[model samples]
Target chain A: MAVPRELRQISDAVWELPVSWKPGMRVPARLYGTRDLVEHFDDGVFEQAANVATLPGIQKYSFCMPDGHWGYGFPIGGVAAFDPDEGVISPGGIGFDINCGMRLVATNLTCGEVEPHLHRLVDRLFERIPSGVGSTGFVKLDEDEFLDVVEQGSRWCLRNGYALPEDLELTEEQGCMEGADAAKVSHKAVQRGHNQIGTLGSGNHYLEVQVARKENIFNPGLARAFGITMPDQVVVMYHCGSRGFGHQVATDYLHVLLDVMERVYGIRIIDKELACAPFRSPQGQDYFSAMKCAVNMSFANRQVILHRVREVFSDVFGKSPDDLGIRQVYDVTHNTAKLEEHVIDGRRRRVLIHRKGSTRAFGPGMEGIPERYKPFGQPVIIGGSMETGSYLLAGVESGDQTFYSTAHGSGRVMSRHSARKKYQGKKLVREMQFRGIYVRTASLRGLAEEAGGAYKDIDAVARASELAGISTPVAKLTPIGNIKG
Target chain B: MPYTYLEEIAIADVAFEARADTREALFVEAGDALMNVMVEDLKSVRPLVRRSFHAQAEDLERLLFEYLQQFIFFKDAEQLLLRVSKVAITQETGVLGLTAEAAGEKIDPSRHDLNADVKAVTLHRFRVRNEPAGLIATVVLDI
Candidate 1:
């Protein structure tokens, strides 16, 4: 797709489409990426950005990060903020996988100490952690019990002896975001979530065991703050979301918003996928409250998965997780609509910040971050492809220019069908095994679709993120073993 | 083939266009297309469960949207793999009515080869059009 002629280059890594470029735009649309990255973006990014700019009470500009790509309503890696009182809340901006996020756990065991037992460890982890389509976890809750999990978030994990107290502090929003209304969630959604609490669902969701060496640390101080003290440290990462619970919530609300936007509110939507309601409206508040429940459910889900990971490690190494120093570094979400206070035009105003396929990168001294991480800033975990490496970045103080958001992953550049034509799952599995990265998946066709050739280069994305001033590099970790769902 | 797989618009997303002489056949074929994404064989499982669904919308677009969503809801809630056996569509003025009956059995991994889970039917590029041969419906599934 051709880049829109109206887009003007603001800097080597930034482009802008002025409000005049489109008829209904209330503000300009800004895109941040290296020149190469910008050229790789689909034209859908600009179209969605322009459409988002036309929404009511959008502050600053509609923004897209370096990894931005075509998505249903908002382009992946899109960011937009709207005033709580005057603006609207759109689930399309939040994505279907509500609160879809990443969590990093650091262990005292080094690569050298665990290498001889690597195969066994991977096998054990795969066995202990339920994954793949139609897979269920150990947590089977009734309607009342499921609602409790929704309301308590990770606190439910702590009470059920699945997590530690420190785990909550390192998690975003203390792992218990406020405003959850379980009653607002549907009975069908609850039933869908009843048995999926700790399972990793299929499609782009997985658990990877990586090794980070001290030599890879970009900022030694920040790395130490994140508990990366030694070279060749073994760390485990989980990338998942609220599962079917969140999907049903978004699906149900989209129907309501589509009807109310036209019949009751009389608001015109540029795209049916962008269905929404005014933030303060009864319909909007109800969706927000229900979305909070999905968010907490996801938090509790990951917390329980962490407990399972600890058990696998203990079983393999013959020691307790506490003695193994297996502690959570941080857990942050990418897909959400959060009500936060940010200084715009030198005044603190409450706004709903919607980040779709983008990570929240809060700079140092931001409220809600852990006290120990206050000076170092929040940890931003970017999961690269199965073959490429991942990175650990911190939010910069100057990140406020784009509402303090950054890219979530090395975004896909090729279509899945194109990828399947180029790579074979069996051959790719052999290649990964030769590269010392053990690969396990339930479906080979699904594996072929996720070939590393389908996505952009991680190093380039990390560099563009730093150059754009949204996040700063702290450490780089390479994968030793990966489990794909 | 009852349905033809459509070209993907974005990486990892799945879509299909179902066609039949009648609206009922189109709905049944659409269900088969959705279930095939999760399992390799459609005829391997027995009919252990039978379910019925009814939905109404102001237009055909919204009605098809609700119809596809019902299959996903059942898959997640009951662990059932369903194929729509019968469907009926009616219209009076602007209101559209849809009734569907589907039959399937539990998902047993040993017997059925499970594939990617179809999360939900997305609104992007979803449509129902009348072609020269028959009624054709297009759907994009969020996998």
Candidate 2:
């Protein structure tokens, strides 16, 4: 896709499309990436970002992070903030998998110690933490019990003996985001999510055991502060979300908003997927409350999965997780909308910030981060392809620009169908094994779809993120074993 | 019922275009496309269980959206894999109504070759188009 002729290079890695780029745009659209990254973005991203700019009450700019790619309405890796009183909230900006995020756990064991028992460990994690299509979690809950889980988030995990108190402390929003309203969620959502507590739902969702050698550390001091005390230390990372619960919530509301958006509110949306209601409206408030249920549901889901990770590791190592020093580094989400206070126009204003396929990288000393890491900023976990390496990053003061947002992962460059057509899952598995990365998957076709060639360069993405100053890399972690869904 | 996947969009999600001469046939084709996304081989699924769905919308677009969403709802809520075996579309008063009878069985991972889970049918590029010869519905399934 050709870069829009009017897109101006405002900075080394930033490009701005003025409001005039599209009709009815209330604000300009801003994209951040190195030149190569920007050039490789799908053609749909620019059009969708411009469309998002037209939404009512969008503030500053409709920002697309370095990893931005074509998504349904707003481009994935998009961020935007709007006034709660006058602005609108759109689910398309939040994604179907609400709070679909990343969690990293550090262990004292080194790669050498882990490599010997790595296969047994990976097999155990895959069995205990279910993956693939239609896989349900070991946790069973009736409708009433499910409601309690969503309302309390990870607190339910703590009560159920699935999580420690510090686990919640290291989590975003303490794993229990405020304002969840169980009454707002529908019975359909309850039915979809009731039994899915610890399972990892499919499509790019996975549990991987990774390793960070000494050379992978970009900022040793920050890494050590986060419990990566030993060279070649092993860690665990997984990505998933609210599963069927979030999808049902988003689907239910999209229908409600579509029926009422134009008819009741008279708001014009370029794409039906961007249909929204004014934040203060009854419909908007109802959707917001319901969305929070999914958010909390996701937090609880990850906490339970973390518990399973610990269980599997303990069983394989024949030692307790604490003995192995399995502590949470941090839990962060990429898909969400939260009410946050930022210095907008030199005044502190509470705005609803939507991050779709983008991570909130609150700078050092920013409100919302754990007190222990106050001087180092919030930990930002950006996952990469199963065949590539991932990154550990810290927010920077300069991140205030995109409302302290950063790229979520090595964003996709190829479509799944295209990648599937080009790669053989069986061969890819063998090739990966030869490269010292053990692999297991629930679906071979899915494995083909997620071939390494499908994604952008993670090293380049991390460098672009640092150069753009949204977040700075703390360390790089290579995948030693993978369990793909 | 004739439908072909439109090669996944830029993201990992899949899209398909379904067409037929009648709205009823369009429903069948679209429903088949949705089921096909989750199950690698539709032929592998047998009519071991049967279920019916009813949806009412003000327009064709919303009706199609609601109808397709039923399969995903059943897949998640009931652990059932289904295909539209029979369907009827009625236009009465101001409401567009659809009554569909679907048949499949409990998702047996051993029997039904499973693929990606279709999270929801997205509104992006969703359409029900009328033509001289027939009707066309373009749907995108978020995997």
Candidate 3:
């Protein structure tokens, strides 16, 4: 669809829709993208952004990043912060895959060293890490122990010998978020999560081995600080979430909010997908608490997988994990609502920031970041499609305008069915192999659905993010191997 | 058509319309449509494993929601990739209840050509309505 008629061009990379553009909008809607990207955006992006502006007690503006696309209620790259007292908590704002984020591990091994074993490494990694639909992980928790898994997050992983303590420190919220009450999560959700702790769920989820290219390093010093120092440095990136646990939590809460939204709060929503409850209401607090459990579960999930990744590298390279120096660079969640303090209108106030398919890009000196990362800012891991390659970026000062949030991935441009119709997964696999990227996948059809042509250009999306000044590129990593779930 | 996949929704998601002469048939067809999105062929699924599911909701629409969610729950929890074999719906005093039977086997990558692992059935444009022919259900799935 064409750009909204009333959208005002704020800059080359920013556009705004005045509150008057919609009847009940409490704030304006701001979207970040270059002209070409915005022009290619799905129609739902504008509709969802406009609907977000009308939510209760929205602060500043409803924002969409460069890779914005049509999601259920919010645009995929949508970011909106709400006042604690007057605003509402939306399940749609966080998405079904709660804490669906990226974890980057920097290894001392280089492409030159891994090239001979790239195929074997991919095979071993795929075999070691459970993935795809209905895949089960090594961790199985009973009722009581499951609570610890959700409540402790990566801390549980550390205690269970699944992660190093430093892994948690490099993770957002230190890998464990507060306010999680296992009792708040449904028994069904627990059942779904129990056997799936470390399994990577299907659909756009993957584990990729990549090589950092020196020419792509925009900020060499920053890259070095984040653990990348030389060209061809090998890194592993995993993209996943709380498995079925998070999906169930969102499903359960959406029903609750739908039942109470209009009657209890007298709130009107344009779409049922945007269902929510007042932040302080029992229903809202319960959902929030349950959501935190999913958030922590995801952290623990990735932490366990990180350990498995380390094991595979050690086994393949014949070096101890410690000797390999396969340290976690960072882990950042893109789909979540965190209670944070951001300065708005010259006032520092606590707000619930909802980042649906948007990564947290807190700039240097942000209060919540770790002491070591304070100087270089938080590392934002943006995973592109298998073909386009990914990037390691750092939050920049200007990002405060978007509440320190940025694009999460190269958003899809074609439907799965369309991609399947146009491309063959086996052929694509061969193509990737010919290009020197080994691939292991569960389903050929599923693989075809993620054809590179189906997504926006990762380079262009990253450029728009930098031009918009929300985040600055640090280093680019090209994939050497990939495993798809 | 009992059901036809719709193409207007976002590229990352799957949307489809299910229709039948009765709500029960519509519900059955809807479940089948959901399963078809994941597997290349529904007939390939054997009835070696069977499950019984019961759901109740304030209305028919919500009942459909609960039914579809059960399919996803089973897929994740039991590793059962099922097809709705039978569906019976009862409506009384504005409440709708459903009893359904699903039959299939575990998802085997070697045996089954999987397309997508549907995360959940979303409420985005989700609805059931009566039409000239009978009833129609429209659903957008998060895959």
Residues A1-485, candidate 2: write the lDDT tens digits: 79889989988888999999899999999999998898888888899999999988899999999988988788999999999988999999999999999999999899999999989998888788888887889988888999999999999999999999999999999998888999998888899899888888888898889999899999999998888888899999999999999999998898788789989999989998897999999989999999999999999999999999999999999999999999999999989989999999899999999999999999999889999989999999999999988999999999989999999999988887888889988999999999988988888888888888999999888898899899999999999899987
Candidate 3 per-residue lDDT, tens place, A265-285, comes to 999998888999999999999
CAPRI-style grade of the A/B interface in model 1: medium
Q: Write the per-residue lDDT of candidate 1 for residues A147-241, one digit (tens) a residue.
A: 99998899989999988999999999989888899999999889888789998888888899999877788998999999998999999998999
lDDT of 1 at A311: 95
Native contacts retained by model 2, as a fraction? 0.72
Q: Which regions of candidate 1 deviate over 4 angstroms?
A: B90-95
Clashing pairs in 1: none
lDDT for residue B61 in candidate 2, whole number 0-100: 84
Off by over 4 Å in 3: none
Q: If the candidates were sorted by their DockQ against the true structure, best first, what order would they fall in?
A: 3, 2, 1
Candidate 1 chain A, which ten residues in sequence have the lowest lDDT sum?
A: A412-421
